[model samples]
Target: MSNRNKKIIIYICCAFIVAIIFYLFPHFYSTTMREAFIYFPEDDQIEFIDASTNIKLIDTKDENEYYLEWKTASETDKKAYLRQDIGFIFENGVLISTQSEWREKTKKLKNKVTLHGEDSGRYEAITFHFAEVHYPDDIIKSKQIMTEDKHYVIDTPLSPLVDFKKAKSQSEQRGKELLDSIIDQQLTYTVEGLIEQFKINKESYHIFPLTEIAQFQTEPLPSMSQEETNAVIGRMWEGLYRYYLLGTNTFTEETYDPIGNTMPFVFLSKDDTHLLVLYETADKKGQQLLQLIPKSEDNENLSKNEQ
Candidate 1:
């Protein structure tokens, strides 16, 4: 072959090689990642399970049963229960994500008659309130299940507050567009219905309240102090509680505003084998399902050393 033709042939060979590598890249990366990060538990202890024998926060038929078990469970068992129940369980580890639930209340007034009221010909009124409260079961059920083991979440690479702000800004802009579209079409619908359809679509925002600390390693290090635990728990609880409340309420424009500066919660595991930190910011990809694998001692040490 002429030199020019040989050069062209060489270039084509190089291109073919690059294309093959590229085609195999994702499969290679996925296999490597799964091997490196995924760890399945063998003979794992079942701290809690529903009547059907599936893992769950509580079986709707008998919530009291789980509560009774939890009361006597060791700290380790408690953590395990909460981690699998409320937090995101990957393999052996769990991601302590924010948690929240839906709540509703109805009020009614009834007239009551007493001897004194009858005599006076006056009406006495009694007020009653009924509320709808949910356990972890309801919260998990609402989230989109990516697979048998994965779930979707609205992720943020920054602090939770920043994520909330971005969500709010986006929500407001979307809300305005929806509102404008309604006006343009001159549709006759209830204001609440329009807002419900246009604004607060539950599927889009899986509101997770920061209620539990199962995502952290609860094992206090020898150098760790009770004061440290108290501080961490206290700070985390406040933020989690506030966020939970925000999630429970209707998605109004005002509700999207940032609450304040808050740090993600962290806790030690009961075994002191791992340190779990909550909300290190996550990538917005692949359903945002948080999964964790056991952190080997070497990786843990390396993480601490880097820190």
Candidate 2:
């Protein structure tokens, strides 16, 4: 081949390679660094059934499972029961994404409430709230609440079910208290703050809040005995109440602005075997759930070495 032709062919190959790399870079990043997985209970134990298939997702012999009553009850009698659809996204052997939809219908109120949460790995989780009410004389009402930058951002003409006005008022009052406390004590609300609050040896331990924790808890695995399930959930709430006591570690951290709001609290045992998280629910109804998350294998080993 002529030298000029050879040079042209080389240039073309280089260009093609660069173009291919550019085209694939986003997919690579998204699958690797940008994605996170929920590997708490191992992948095999959890099943993801597509809603369109109408297949039974949970098959347990225990009648005390929360869903059993809803599953067996008649449609008209299923009031106040909640139905949940949870999904996980896995890439390779890691869980990179997860989402859940919960719906509950109350016969007395003649209303339906839905809550959705999607976590696409660290710092990228969001919750959406929706409610619909059917009133007598053929009147219907609906409302939606969404989050922006980790703070609830509600539109005006708020839903009657979710009184954003009241929440805002309460938030303002609590926010002032939080600011005053932080100013009076010079306390920080980050991981560093947690370490100091517990007098933790930073070199020997790691700490984080529920927002930064893994996508799911490691215990209470699916098909757990009814007693076991209750115990785990019960512990979570208990931990929350214990930590939520006034004049304790409770504090508010601002999100994207100076308007402060209550934040989740973490409890790490003295021996570092147990990690409990207590945080408010997405509904913003002053309700919270306690969760116990097992330390990641890597962190556990690191802590052991430091000890």
Candidate 3:
């Protein structure tokens, strides 16, 4: 071949290589990013009680006795709070019996209030204790005046845990449907009504779209430290602002422009005993998850006071 023909072939080869690299780069980057947050089985000493639900059995080998450890996937290496020794009898990986102690010990008190929106109407303000537990100290401090109660409990039957692995693998539409069904099953009140009310009273309710919350969770703010950023990410998996809506007395400064002028909303059971939150996953892949939380009696006096 002549000199010009040889040069043209070399140029074409270089362009093809460039195109291949560009196509593969995003996949490589995304995989690396996801791996950094994943907690491998070898990283921790505890063995999983149920990999489906990400439930770990800590310290004891007895199948009958369980010290259930619960935490976000990102914080698996860190010490997990909400460790409960629920005396459960397991036979071949199935729960055979629930001890009376488990029933009596599961109750905890939750902060409850009534939100009166000027245009949005009235709503029962149920505090998300999960948010308080996982959020950074500064975020907690800013919202402390909203309530004095500080207790967290997970009623497994009412508030079913999510399988993070399953959620990430599912299609976006299926994920949304799964979330909707979970919420609908547990809720005694109407979520549609709450959403309709929020539409008319947007300013009063302070309701925001899921997109804004996703941005807040996935992107680190300029003011945030590494620790704070990690905590926020952890909170996303635990399903606070991501899946559920928290009630506040005053309107927040940030504004959201929801698609079709409609805002996403959560469902609360009667007397705010249960809450169902629908939110996008932390990966921002348009897939969503439902987080169900149930209020338990903290103490005899608190339960009686509310009654």
Candidate 4:
């Protein structure tokens, strides 16, 4: 083959070779399809089920249940933080991302991980939340699951405080302050439709404190005797309570925009892990506010799931 033809042939061969490597070793190969696979138990093979994103917060009558509430400010009028009944599932605790099909791997990272996608958009890096958690059958059946909201928030607050520049700044400041105030504000609400439709007892309801450390971890062990389950769950519960007392809890909400100087995204894990928002500036801030997340993995089920 001529030199040019030879060069073209080499390019094609390299492309085909790269594609094969990507298919087999995606982590070493493909770059854009990073995702988080949260297995309920603490293990490597636990696969997340496919579902739509219509999860709402539940308000609890009993301390065990939970509720949903949204807070935002209005621009035209003074914005109100509206609390309403939405979708909610009972969980020992509460908790995102996209879809990808890359399960059949040779090696495994055994731990329930919160996979964080790097900005390079190359390899997906998942930071584990907890090692693993153990739950009793009763809590699993009784506890409801809480979902997140991915919506736009309105900033209400403009004018009169000063001039045009100050007015703009004032509105921005209000939003920032509001969101800042709520960073540790415990979020609580009631369960959905079941109550409005049926006259349920005031006792069946529950709410979870949305703070920085209200997290519960999933263990590697499956269902066990009630005594064992409660013992384990008890320890986890104690940890969560401690977090609440210290005022160090952080619940995950997608939209937080007050005056815009606050660390907007905070997540409280069931395992008592604290996800915090670190801000770089006071105002006219820079744009680097990603939560510094740690990996809390429960990959004990690693060996069992393989079979």
Say which candidate scores most in lDDT: 2
Pick the TM-score winner.
2
Model 1 Cα lDDT, one tens digit per residue, 1-307: 8999999999999999978987977345443332111111111232222111012222112211111001101111112211111112221111222212111121211121111100001011111111112235332111100101211112122312111112247654454344336432431232223334434333332222222332222443234443333233333333333332232122232333222112222334444333322331222111111112233454345334433
Give candidate 2 regions above 4 Å deviation: 1-189, 203-206, 217-234, 237-262, 265-273, 276-307
Decide which is better by lDDT, 1 or 3. Answer: 3
* lDDT scores of the candidates, listed in order: 0.26, 0.32, 0.27, 0.27
lDDT by residue for model 3 over 191-258, one digit each (tens)?
Answer: 33443533433233323322233343345423444334333334333343312222111124222321
Task: Kindly list the per-residue Cα lDDT of model 4 for residues 161-239, writing each as its tens digit.
Answer: 1111122454555644454354334221122222232343324322233321113323221333332332333333333
Positional deviation of 52 in candidate 2, in angstroms?
17
Candidate 4 stretches with Cα past 4 Å from truth are: 1-31, 40-203, 210-307
lDDT of 2: 0.32
What is the TM-score of candidate 4?
0.23
Clash tally, candidates in order: 12, 3, 6, 65
Q: What TM-score does candidate 3 get on C-alpha atoms?
A: 0.20
**Sort by lDDT, top down from the best:** 2, 3, 4, 1
Which scores greater on TM-score, model 2 or model 4?
2
- Please give, for residues 118-175, the per-residue lDDT of candidate 2 as tens digits: 2111112222222333445543333222221121222122221111112357644454
> Between the candidate structures 3 and 4, which one is better when assessed by lDDT?
3
